[model samples]
Target: MLSLSDLRQRPLNVLCAGDVERHETTEWANSDDIDVRNRFADLLQRAFHA
Candidate 1:
């Protein structure tokens, strides 16, 4: 797990909470649930807007 301080030290555009795996492409690698995806989208929006 990454601490707040650790995250603050890096440049992060989006943060998703789930079991993620490395993928060959740039596609999503976490949960496929609609709710999860929606939340992730919201987070991504906030990240960029902030």
Candidate 2:
């Protein structure tokens, strides 16, 4: 199976993914197609900082 960890090690200029269903965001995620940019941003912030 393919994964971000595998791809992260290769030489690449860009990386992307979609469809994160966070259980905590139930109150604001009124639509399935909604773009949760802030949620991903927060995750990335924590990922890099930690």
Candidate 3:
């Protein structure tokens, strides 16, 4: 986990598992895609500053 102070101290870059075109769907939540799942996790991590 990363603290807010730590996040402010450095740049935070979130990378997708593949091409951007591959993840251009609005479906997330219960999607069965690994890339979508990983992207969702990334979103949560940033939102909670974890």
Query: What TM-score do all the candidates reach, one by one?
Result: 0.40, 0.32, 0.42
Off by over 4 Å in 1: 1-30
Sort all candidates by TM-score, best to worst: 3, 1, 2
User: Cα deviation of 48 in candidate 1 (Å)?
Assistant: 0.3
Worst 10 residues of 3 by lDDT: 1-10
Candidate 2's residue-wise lDDT over 1-50, tens digit each? 12223333334314535433324444434435446645545555676887
Local lDDT at 15 for model 1: 60
**lDDT tens readout by residue for model 1, 1-50:** 32222332335424635443433212432666766556556656676786
TM-score result, candidate 1: 0.40
The Cα error of candidate 3 at residue 44, in Å, is 0.6
- Largest lDDT belongs to which candidate? 3
- Model 3 TM: 0.42
Model 3 lDDT per residue over 1-50, tens place? 32223332325323333323323235664688888667776776897874
Instruction: Give the winner by TM-score: 2 or 3.
Output: 3
RMSD (Å) of each candidate, 1 decimal: 7.7, 9.9, 8.3
Candidate with better lDDT, 1 vs 2: 1
- List where candidate 2 sits over 4 angstroms from the true fold: 1-35
List ranges where model 3 is wrong by over 4 Å.
1-26
